[model samples]
Target: MSRSARAIAVNAALVLAAGLTLLPLAWMVSVSLMPTGEASRLPLRLLPSAPTLEHYRTLFTRLDVAGYAANSALLATAVTAISLVLNSMAGYAFAKLPFRGRDALFRTLLAALVIPAQVGMLPLFLMLKGMGLINTYAGVVIPGLASIFGIFLVRQYAQSIPDSLLDAARIDGAGELRIYRSFVLPACTPILTTLALFTFMGTWNDFLWPLIVLSDQDRFTLPVALANLLGEHAQDVELMMAGSVLTVAPMVVLFLALQRYYVAGVVSGSVKG
Candidate 1:
């Protein structure tokens, strides 16, 4: 093939792939506005014969998706906030602080990363149940409070900070917490934003743990609620699509906003490793 032909072919392939990937998402939105039974008709139509938001209304009013949305928001926010604090503390300590067995301890944790979190999930669930948090938001929040990967991400980024800066702070009588809050936090803003985005999205999209722990319908996160909605409203294609859209929209927006930082973190970590 000629060079231009090859380039044209590559561009065409990329456009095809993008369309393929977006097809389902596009269909979801289209069907969300479709009349109740139109999506499941004899022919697969790309659009509603007559578009409407009635299904969205049903989700918010009768189906009580608003509650599920609130639960999802609360859980995602809580997990992100808690993980930020814990991960930053552990990460900063690992990077800058001199302590007994620091390298060994971090090494142990690095090894622990090889262990699937699922391995400990059984015991963790039992522990949470014993504490009466099984059906509560706290149950969902506990396991994600500190992710090994989150800590490692922050640590790798923190290591880039000059030792002289920390030493200067120490000599100037700045306490560890002060240094962390004022200096480290500012310096780590990019990664912190990235991690917050990661944690929030993970928590929002989580299905298994939330499915296992939360038994109450009132406390169900959006994903769990959507699953439940699927059970009763298999016939309501428009409503299901609206629920899917709501469930996906926030995380997508967040990712687009912080994608640069997230991608940068990935590239930096790969190079460092």
Candidate 2:
């Protein structure tokens, strides 16, 4: 094929692929807007005969979805903010600071990553229970405050920062914390943005940990609350779709807003580190 033809072919294929990927999400929104029985009709209507916000209204007004959403927002925000600081500090230390056994400790952490997270959950749960943190938001946020993967990502990106910059800051009488605040954080912005997106999405979509930790219905996050909603309203297909949309919408918006930074961070981190 000629070059122009190949380019046209590739673009067509990409458009087709994008449409296929988005079709389900489009259908999901459609179903959520559908009247009560419209989604489950015999023909499987792709579009609602009469779109309405009834299901969404029901979710927010009667089902307390707004409260659950609030809980999710609070937890996700807290986890993302705290984890970024902890991860960035640790990552920078690993990359630049001369500390005793730093390499060994980092290596050990990497090795631990090979072990399944589920394996440690039981002990972690027990430890938290002993501390009387069970059924609290802290229980959910504590475990996610520092992750091996987060630390690794930050360390790799931090390593790409020129050593002379840090040395220059130090020579000018900048303390370690000052240098971190003024220089390291700014230089690592792309990676940090990427990390923030990952952390927020992960925490927002998390279901299992919240389910295990929070027994109170009022304390439940969106995912856990949605699951509970499913059990009680299995036949309410439209309502369920609305709930799913609510749960998913925030993350979609977040990703869209930060997409450029996210892509840049991933590309830079991979190539530089």
Candidate 3:
């Protein structure tokens, strides 16, 4: 094939793939707007024959989806805040501090990442149960309170900080905590923003662990509660779409808002490595 022909083929293939990927999102919106019971009819309807917001209304008013939405928002925000403080400090210390066995310790923790978190999940659930954390916001908030990737992300970014900065802080009577809070943390705003986005989105979209831990209806995040909603309201296609929208929209918006940071982190890490 000629070079021009190959380029055309590649572009065509990309467009096709993009369309294929977007098909479900398109269908979800279409099905969500459809009136009470028309999505599963004989001929596939690409758009709602008569689009309506009744399903969205039902989700908010009758079905109590708003509660689940609030739970997801609060849990994600809390986890993001906590993860920022814990991971950023740990990352900075690892990057800049002089400590014995620091590399070994970080390596050990990194190795733990290879061990699927799910492996300990059963024991974790039992441990949480023992602590009476299950069925509570703390249960949802605890596991994500810190993450290996978060540390690694901040560490990567912190490694870029000049030692002169920390030395300057120390000469001015700054403690380690003070140095981190004033110098390192602010220096890491770009990456911290990136990590915050990552943590929030991960915590918001979390399904499995939350499903296992939060057995109480009141504590269910949007994904878990939506699953339960599916069981009872499978026939409500539009409603399910609305739930899917509510579940996905916040995450999509967050990524768009902070995409610069996410992209910067990726690029910086790549160059640093």
TM-score winner: 1
| Candidate 2 off by > 4 Å | 1-12, 264-273
lDDT of 2 at 170: 93
Tens digit per residue, CA lDDT, model 2, 13-94: 9999999999989988999999999887897689999889999999889999999999999999999999999999999999
The total of clashing pairs for model 3 equals 0
Between 1 and 2, whose lDDT is larger?
2
Give the Å shift of residue 107 in candidate 3: 1.2
Error of 1 at 174 (Å): 0.9
lDDT tens string, model 1, 1-273?
Answer: 999999999999999999999999999999999988898888778988998999889889898888998999999999999999999999999999979999999989988877877898999998987899999989999999898888899999899889899889989999989999989999999999888888888899999999999999999999999999899988878888999999998878887878897788778667745
Clash totals, every prediction: 0, 0, 0
Q: Which stretches of candidate 3 lie over 4 Å from their true place?
A: 1-7, 264-273
lDDT of 3 at 74: 93
Query: In model 1, what lDDT does residue 19 have?
Result: 100
TM, every model:
0.96, 0.92, 0.93
How large is the C-alpha RMSD of every model relative to the true structure?
A: 1.3, 2.0, 2.0
